[model samples]
Target: MEENIRRNKIVGSRRFSNYFWTIFLFIGGFSFLLAGLSTYLKINLLPFANPTQLAFIPQGLVMIFYGTLSLSFSIYILLTLFWDIGSGYNEYNKLENLVKIVRKGFPGKNREILLTYPLNSIKSIGIKISEGLNPKRIVYLCLKDERKIPLTPVQQPNSISILEEEASDLAKFLDLKLENL
Candidate 1:
């Protein structure tokens, strides 16, 4: 039966887009910072642009502000990537009659977020789909307590058919109803 089958899905946050953005931001921020510094120091810091001739009162100052903001944001994203936040696994164990969802969060008291629910508490498996500019296809676990906990990771949306099939399989394994929302 489907119930006897074990499923453990691993989710990761180290995507190509994440890496691309981090590098892009860093380079852009650093270039801006150097240009601003060149104006203040009266020295050519960047090989491509000569910012030393620019007035520091407005032009240089604006560059510095934008650079700082971008740099700070890039650092934040880098930290999240380094920590591998949101990377974890979902384990559905029929022998233990439990569904475990574990994920890594920011460093602190709740760095490791672990959630466990009894198999009986799962009322149904749900699939939510939205098409358009920001398309989203997600699978959720509908519990008896009316909580719709997402079982899928936050990433690029999966195709509708694949998502539906996964939801159906999960529903059958748990012997619960399937709801498409």
Candidate 2:
């Protein structure tokens, strides 16, 4: 039972992340560009008209404050984008690590199992689709619970059967009574 078996092989979508960063870059770049254009044209685009006359502070100070705030927000979003870019997608390995199988009663049941893994302990989790171009989805396998003998990814379309197999196997392995949903 301890023989290593690599099972989960689901990959997450990077397109969504890419699109998010692209949008942020456009917005941030435009913001800075507009700020530069405003300075070059000597146009006060502040929300309030004649801000210099309304505020006791100098116009330059107000521009500095607004520019700094916008740039800071942009910087933060860009930093997250870069981090995601650096940590590329990875394949899930279920063989070497312990795995857990959870069964919840029909929707709205309060039953659940709480399991924790070291911050980076999990290799990855698997997300399965029903068929080519189908919207149906399911979480195929959870990488660590220290109870069940991790099941291999089901090549078939039925996820419920796979879940049942994993849960029963896990219950026997842990010697605990787990009711199936």
Candidate 3:
């Protein structure tokens, strides 16, 4: 039917892993910062450790530097999580004979990214799988103009079968071929 439409929602930085990292970084950084301050002031700022015995020149300064770096990284992650960046949906509308890909970006004029193309322009659905240190499983929409738009989120890697099934399902819905790359 020409009125048929399909939509798939994608998750973003609001996942459990992101939350865990944010909390971990914040706690670790705060601890280091307190320890460094305790050494400089000759006082026990951290309840767990007596950093007043540590030297203020190198050890305390190094701790402060590392703490700053960790806090900055955690803040960046927190902002992304708050914004729910990269969260969006893919819509295949048979009625309009079009496909729409939408995603959220950083706070700016181009925060919301929306890409639309004719449904017929979809050449195939592609699945890419890689293992080892940095494992990745991703699904991509291959277009006629040689553009490959990734559909899957960059979180935990999905199983091979799951990736294959998702790609096949999308390919069938779009009436396009499925390619395993």
Best candidate, TM-score: 3
Q: Write the per-residue lDDT of candidate 3 for residues 66-129, one digit (tens) a residue.
A: 8988898899999999999999999989889888989999999999999998988888998888
Top-lDDT structure, candidate number: 3
RMSD of 3: 1.4
After superposition, which runs of candidate 3 have C-alpha atoms over 4 Å from their true positions?
Answer: 1-3
Q: Please give the lDDT score for candidate 3.
A: 0.90
For model 1, the superposed segments whose C-alpha errors exceed 4 Å read 1-5
Backbone clashes under 3 angstroms, per model: 0, 1, 0
Q: What lDDT would each prediction earn against the true structure? A: 0.87, 0.41, 0.90
Span of 10 residues, lowest total lDDT, candidate 2: 84-93
Sort by TM-score, best first. 3, 1, 2
Model 2 CA lDDT for position 45: 55
lDDT of 2 by residue, 91-181 (tens): 2224434343332222234434323333234333344344566534344333345322223322234565665565555434333344421
Which run of 10 residues does model 1 get worst, by summed lDDT?
A: 1-10
**What's the lDDT of the predicted structure labeled candidate 2?**
0.41
lDDT of 3 at 78: 99
Residue-wise lDDT of candidate 1 within 1-181, one digit each (tens)? 4556465555666778888888899899999999998999999999988999999989999999989888888898888889998998887878888899999999999999999999999888988998899998989999999999998888999888888888898888778899986
lDDT of prediction 1: 0.87
Output the TM-score of candidate 3. 0.96
